[model samples]
Structures are given as C-alpha cells and as structure tokens.
Target chain A: MERVPVLKIGDILLVSIQIDMEDQVALQLQEDLAERIVATGVHGVIIDISALDIVDSFVGRTLATIAAVSRVLDAETVVVGMRPAVAITLVELGLSLPGIRTALNVELGIALLGKRDVGDEPADDEDEDDPAAVTTS
Target chain B: MERVPVLKIGDILLVSIQIDMEDQVALQLQEDLAERIVATGVHGVIIDISALDIVDSFVGRTLATIAAVSRVLDAETVVVGMRPAVAITLVELGLSLPGIRTALNVELGIALLGKRDVGDEPADDEDEDDPAAVTTS
Candidate 1:
C-alpha cells in the first residue's frame, strides 16, 4: 500500500495524489492528512488531484471529509487540478463536495489559500505578475 | 408558468424558489437571472432553496449554470438551505454543483455574500453576536 505524501510549504500542507487510490488508501490518506494538519498547525491545505482520472463516491467523500476535518482544525482546503471530465462526472454522480473550494491548478490553489490566510490584504502583488493569477477568475 | 421572483435587497439579488421547478421553469429562471445580474450590477446573489425537497440533474445543472453566468457577470452566487437528504441524493447521483457556494440557511448565505462583497472589511460585527457565525467554521 502506497502512502500519499503530504508536503509542507510554509504554513500550507500540499498533498499530491499521483495514483488511482484504493478505498483503503483513500481512508488512510484522510487519516494521515488529519494527523499531519494537527501536528503542523498549518493554516491551509492544497490537494492536487490532477492525476486522478476518476473519482467514485468513496473517493469523493474522503475528499470532503478531509476538507471538513481541516476546517475544524482551522485550516482551509483547496482542491486543484481536477480535469474537466472528472468535474462533469462528479456533478453527474451527484457529489458536489460542498464546502470544498477548488482551483484549476496547484498555483491557483496556493493563491487561494494565501488569500484566505491573509484575510484582507490587497490581492497579492505577485499574482498580477503571473499568468496563473488569471486562473482564479 | 410561475416565475421565480428575483428580489433586490441592497446590492444583492435574493431569489427564493418555492416550487419543485420544471425543466422549462429552471431554464427560464436561468435566463431571467442572468439578465437581472447584468442589469442590476449587484455584487452578490442569494438563492433560497429551502422549499425544494428534490433536485434532479436538470435542476442541478441549472444551478451550476446560473453560478457560472453570475461569475462571468462579476456577481457571486450562494445557494442556501439545502436539506441533508437532498445533498446526499445529489452526491449519490453524482452532481456536486461545483463552483457554487452553499450555506446552511438564508442568513448565513447572505453573510457569505456580504463578506465576498466587502472583500477586506472587519468580519461582520453582527456575525459575532449571532450564534450562526460559528457555523462558518
């Protein structure tokens, strides 16, 4: 069983799921993520699922649970890199994963978490210089 | 044909859908809503779906489309008051209504819009006094 790696970038935790996850793996990832969040006291979580081509209900629920748990621990979760097909399928399958924020890619995901953490600062100046900034809109 | 009333409250447009909408009605509401958003230049929209017991894919797609349209027009959309069963059914059916924000009730929905519109203002003082502020967490 391969464990999902949760990388820490500044105050955010980055989890990039690069494989098609099994039910057990999904659950384990959820558990591991929650523990990591508590231990690190991160203010944000960015989940990059760009590699996932399909998401069944179990996977979808695990994602939602991760977001919910992170929120309870005072961290924001931004799911990014969802393919268009996966999004259409998720909606077609009736699991909108409410309460979870999404972005087109990891860069935007980080920007979202950054924005949330800063609360009211003027939009990041760095965003204006990067093409990825436009992706948030 | 019953028309969904789109009420203007301050700078936000409030829509309360009281019926299980027909496919045609949903489409009509979408058209009507886009026109209203463009015309009013409102910064936010709160859709009250508390009266809806069931939301099929057609209706779900309509909601997503409405959110997409609003975003393009520079307005934020929040769908409020979804019952737990409806949510479960939606996820089971595979329609997560991505890109659409949701709140537990109308008041919180409005606050979500309020927060989005203000961008950097101090958290709503009223939120501190109301128990509902805790719900965002």
Candidate 2:
C-alpha cells in the first residue's frame, strides 16, 4: 500500500499527489493527512493535484474529508493545481468541494496561507486608499 | 463611465469584469446583472473576475448578492479567475463570497455553467461504477 507523503514547510503541510490514486489510496491519504495535521499543529495544508487527469467522486470526497478534518484541527486546506478537465468533471459529478479554498498553483497556495497568517494588516493598508473597504454589516 | 458588458452566450449570460472596480461600480454590476438575468431568461451567469487584483468586503458582498439574485431568477452564477491575492484578501476581510460557484478560469467557468444545464445526467453515469456516489441526504 503506497502512502502519500506529507511534507511540513514551516508551519504548513504540503501533500503533492504524484500519481493516479485508487480508492483505498485516497482514503489512506485522508487518514494520514488528518493525523499529520493534528501532530504537527500546522496552520495550513496545500494539496497539489496538478498531475491528476481524472478525479472521480471518491477522490473528490476524500479531498473534502481531508479539508473538513483539517479545519476542525485549526488548519485551512487549499487544493491547488487542478486541471481544467478535472474541475469540469468534479463539478459535473455534482461535487463542488465546498469549504475548500483553491488556487491556481502551489505558489499561490503558499501565498494564500501566508496572507491568512498576517490577517487583516495587509488589507488595512489598502483600506487607506479605498474607502469602500468598510465592512458591510 | 465604463459599464461591465454582459454578453449572452447561448442560454447563459457571461459578464467579464475587465478592470479593477470601485464599490459603486461593483454595486452597479450587481444590479445590472440581476436585471439582465431576469430580462433574458438565461439559465446561468458567469462573472469573470480574472482582471481584479483586490476584492474588498463591499465587492465581495456584491458578488454574493448577485449570486443570490440570480438564484431567485432561476439562473446559476459562477465567479471565475479570482487572483490568489484577491482571494487571500477577501478571506482575511471575513468574506468567503458564499453561494457562488467558482472556477479557475473563464473557460472552466463556462463549462461549469453548461454542466449545470445538463443537471445530474452525467453524474448518474458514474454512479453505477462508484457506490459512494450516493448523495448523502
């Protein structure tokens, strides 16, 4: 049984799926990722699936499961580098993968994680020039 | 003085925001979009924001508003091509832009709209092979 490797980059965990995953492999990855997220106390997890050409509902649900688990452990999950075909297929399969933040690639994923760490400071700087930054509530 | 163009793509309407928008402009686009959705009887609306670098809370709310209005008008809205910086900024501002389907780019956004038109037919085909495809309801 091949296990997906979870690499810790600073305070974030990175999981790059390099092959077509079987159902069992996907489920194993989900469990492995959840345990690592709790053990490492990481603030973010970036799952890169750029290499995958097909993402059936099982794989999609596993990704969603990993994301939900990470959130409960105080980590945000960003699934990046999804191919256009795979995205179309996922949506067509009626799985929107909600509550999962996504980006075009790993670099942007890292940037998104970093921005969350900084919180509202960067947005505040821009607020000086843009008055509409006022929250509508 | 520039108004966002809403082009009719078959039964779906496409509104590609081509520039960084002010609060008022964003609000106007939301209104224009709602009116168009009702007037045109389109099944879906794709709002492309690939050009935007910053999406403050006001703009984020407007996007949500458009999605809500479209739903009431029997139209689905897919917001596409959000810059990573903008996404990070929006999340930091406490606005997830919920109730809006998002795609990586315009092409995928269009594809998503098309899939919704077909509804669950394609998803049903894969259900036979995958037992987990059972909708959790």
Candidate 3:
C-alpha cells in the first residue's frame, strides 16, 4: 500500500512533507489528494513543506497536479510557507506552475477560501491587493 | 482598520499578503498569526505568494517574521506555490528568506507538516522507487 503523506488538523487535512519528493511520491500524493477531497467534502487544503532541502521540476509539477485534482473534487488548495533557498533553486530551474493557487501562508490560504467568487461582484470587504481580487495580477 | 490583501476560498484562507510589507504590517501579522494559532489550535501554516510581482528585502524579512511567530505559537509554517519568475527575482535582488520554511507547492507544504521534527525519515507508505513501482521518471 502506498502511503500518502498528510495529517489531520481538525476537519482540514494538513500535508507536510520532509522527503526529497521524487516522481513516485508525487503521483501517490496526487491520487491520495483526489480521494481525500471526495471523502472529506472539505474544500480547504493546506500544504506545508518547511523541511525540504531541495525541490526539482518534477516536484513542482506534482504539486500543481494535486491542486488541479483538488479543484475537480470541489476542493480548494493553498500552498504555503516556503524557504528562500528552495524558492530560488526552483525558479532558477525554470519550474513553472501554470494552473495552481498559492498563498503566502496557510492563514491566507484559509482566508482565500472564504472569499466570494469574482462573478458575484465582491463586497467592499475585499482587499485590493488580493490576487483573486485583481484577476491574476 | 487597514485591509490586508487576502484570497478567501469559501471559509478557507488561501493567501495573505502584506504588500510593501513594511515593518508595521509584519508586526501586526505576527500578532495576527499568533492569535490565529491560539484560536484554531491548528499547528499547520502555509504562506503563498504567486501574486507578488516582486519581493523586496522588506517582504523577505516580513515572511521570516511570520515564520517566527508561527513557531512561538507552536504552529508550523511553510511558504509554497511561488512562480519561478518571482522566486528568481527575489533571489537576484539579493532578498533571502532566512529561517523560513518553503515548498514548491501546497501538497508538499502540507506534507511537511506531518513529518518528524528531526532528520528526513522515509514516509511510511510512499517510499518505494523501484522501476516496477509507480514510475513517472
């Protein structure tokens, strides 16, 4: 049985990975995320990776895949907290995440989930700087 | 009250932004995060910023500040889901996030939350990398 790395933080599932995260783990994680999204019926997800020493292109893509799956399952995904060194390495490696949602921290990610979709013409409580608020700015 | 840029998905917070992220916001966010940790009692934290076109020294420092607050609050922080362009720009601008946690995406970030506090121990299930096993390589 493949193990999907994650933990339950209240009703939300908090996934924090400490390994190198090669292709195998990424695939397994994607599958697990899909299943979990359906079972939990929870639209919120927080992915925390503060322990990795390195992240390659494959890892970045896999993360994006999970985000896509989450959306299909009617769940929202938030990628949070990052180390500066790893961030630099990933960018330098030219890893691009095209259809993924991200937040500066889990708190923000949760905040994102609460936001009214743009189609609804957001209320004044809207933050002008919000990415979703500004249409991919 | 000052409005912080945030992406809310349903009730979940996707991303929180303190753009221009001056020291004051940094301090406030620290307090905010601390309060949140105490309130939610959930130790998982993810910071995402695929929106910020540029991350200056102040922004870098602010992220570090948030990470510190999370630790003090007994919460784990992982910054994830940054674009390669933004990562490179931060790195080139000589802005570095010291002592902050980061991952390529939310899934990895979430995965990091469940890891042991020490060295990289293999995940209980997704450790097999043999050719016969799942292969995306």
Reference interface contacts recovered per candidate? 0.00, 0.00, 0.00
Worst lDDT run of 10 residues, candidate 2 chain A, spans A119-128
Rank ordering of all candidates by lDDT, starting from the highest: 1, 2, 3
lDDT tens digits, residues B21-135, model 1? 7787788888888898889778788787755778899889888999999876878899987879999999999999999999986567777877763544443446335665554
What does candidate 2's lDDT look like per residue over A19-108, in tens digits?
457788788888888888889788889888765778888788788888988888878899988889999998899989988889887668
How far does residue A7 in candidate 3 sit from its true spot (Å)? Answer: 3.0
Top candidate by lDDT:
1
Query: Which stretches of model 1 miss by more than 4 angstroms?
Result: A118-137, B1-137
**Model 2, stretches more than 4 Å misplaced?**
A118-137, B1-137
Which of the two, 1 or 2, has more lDDT? 1
Between candidates 2 and 3, the DockQ winner? 3
Per-residue C-alpha lDDT of model 3 across residues B27-66, encoded as one tens digit per residue? 7666766676677566567776543566777777778877
Q: Model 3: per-residue lDDT, tens digit, A15-126? A: 6554447667677877777777677666667776544556777778778878888777766677776667878897788865666666666666656666735224533554
Cα lDDT listed for each candidate: 0.77, 0.75, 0.62
